[model samples]
Target chain A: MLYTVLPLEEVLEGIEQEPGPTVQLTLGGITVEAEPLGNFQARVVRVLSTDPRHFLEPHCQPGFLIHGQIV
Target chain B: MFEQPEAEQLPEREAPGLQTIKELGQTVTPGGPLAEEMPFHCLTIIGQIEGHLVLPPRNKTTKYEHVIPQLVAIEQNPKIKGLLVVLNTVGGDIEAGLAIAEMLKTMTTPVVSLVLGGGHSIGAPIAVAADHSLISETATMTIHPIRLSGLVIGVPQTYEYLDKMQERVIRFIVQHSRIPEETLREMMFRTGELVRDVGTVLVGSEAVRAGLIDEVGGVGTALNRLSQLVAQREGGMH
Candidate 1:
């Protein structure tokens, strides 16, 4: 398998910094949509993969203990 | 005996002023505040999500500019514990809908979404963006490919652009919801589903079965889930 020698943070920085497609098309005063999907998808993938546990963790706060602790 | 506000009574006057503001806001927005100033805030995403372009006057729109700021406030507000997002939209401006969905997905506060009526087009992502999502038994969600209106130049690049945009929507929905990417793509590209459009409309339990929605429920279920989340958070803090 091929791998880059760069550190994980550096690799992530590289992906984050990569410029996306910049296309400009004007049709009858309506500028064509030009969203940077490639960069966004890459970022989302990184977020999902690196922190699967975090993403899966429920957003709600921990529940209260129903039973009282015996001192 | 009821005590009225006197010229010397400042607290009484202030209370009524605050109530007036809340009442006025309730009049303008679809969902209002729950009784007794509950920590959970309710946001209604109705009609079209208007972006840079102004939709027709007759159309009902949830202007992105307005919603974006409200989201920021909800995030910053210390008193707000959770969010309840109610969606009933035909969807509009792909980017705008995605932006809202992204904000909701990334929010630290627990969010529970309930889809009533229809969640079509870009509304699909918004519905699934919440931590827990529900749909009414009669609610329907339309999964369709991205489409452009007016002056279509038959070019390969346009199709490529559309595909990329559609891919973003599918990626977001699959990442947030239980639905798989392949199934969502199939629904988006499905044929003979709509007489005029090429897409599939999953209603209520069907959406849950397809894994697009978390469960089949209504307002009570959505509120109960959100309250539970809030309690869970409070439990965690202690």
Candidate 2:
């Protein structure tokens, strides 16, 4: 159970908001799982790799836009 | 010439350094990697403390595993004179929050917690576990009873652990801070204070008045108090 000061409404806000169309692609050698913004641009969901350094990459930070081919 | 070709061939290797220069206009590099380190290990517990379960990708969560080890490292590290826990959280799993609060209370290292925005629910216990607790002028805290989530199938015995869970939170907070059990309980059951829930929301100085937080101040006040504790401990050792 969430023991927070925030209202229940705020806590559960985006739970059902959107069923995001997510995709996995490689960008800058890191396996990035992202949601496509357009043909070549996508917003990063997460950097799916074992390398901790890859996760620390600013470009791979969640919500960061990535530009690359859909592979 | 070989090094130049390698760097040119691999653009990904240069991204971090190139972006650092673009933003901060400097590079610490390998020679000064520890230059960015500070005497005080500032640990922030923000967002929702989601415990073991990984929340959605968009959810900003402070997971249990993410912080518990840091507390251990801070205790072992000689260079870290004190710990500054900056909290702006909408509390999460009771087990996770209490584990953190218990560790904070037991650690030999001096701790000062600063509450900004809000340190509600389980955050309350963690805040008070510190040597000194400070709250930002506009920050808030919520005092509410712990209730079980999900289904309760058959017997009345289902609530047995729930009662114990709540007791842990209350026992920890009261032991760590000056807030009396009666006062905390009254606040928890104050139905009129909250529109829908049975609870009270303490804003800044109200928390101090309730004896849950030590002072109505922010980052500067917390740091000053922490340094004083560190100095006092060092002097005692000497």
Most accurate candidate by DockQ: 2
Task: Show model 1 residue runs off by greater than 4 Å.
Answer: A1-71, B1-36
Best by TM-score: 2
Chain A TM-score for model 2, please?
0.80
Candidate 1: CAPRI quality band: incorrect
Clashing pairs in 1: A61-B232, A61-B233, A62-B232, A62-B236
List TM-scores for all candidates, in order: 0.66, 0.74
Q: What is the lDDT of residue B98 in candidate 1?
A: 89
Q: Which numbered prediction scores highest in lDDT against the true structure?
A: 2
Give the Å shift of residue B158 in candidate 2: 1.9
- Report DockQ per prediction, comma-separated: 0.02, 0.23
Q: What is the TM-score of chain A alone in each candidate?
A: 0.20, 0.80
- lDDT per residue, candidate 2, B116-168, as tens digits? 99898999999999999999999999989886554555576767777788888
| lDDT agreement of model 2 with the native | 0.80
* lDDT score at residue B156, model 1, on the 0-100 scale: 97
Could you tell me the lDDT of residue A35 within candidate 1?
23
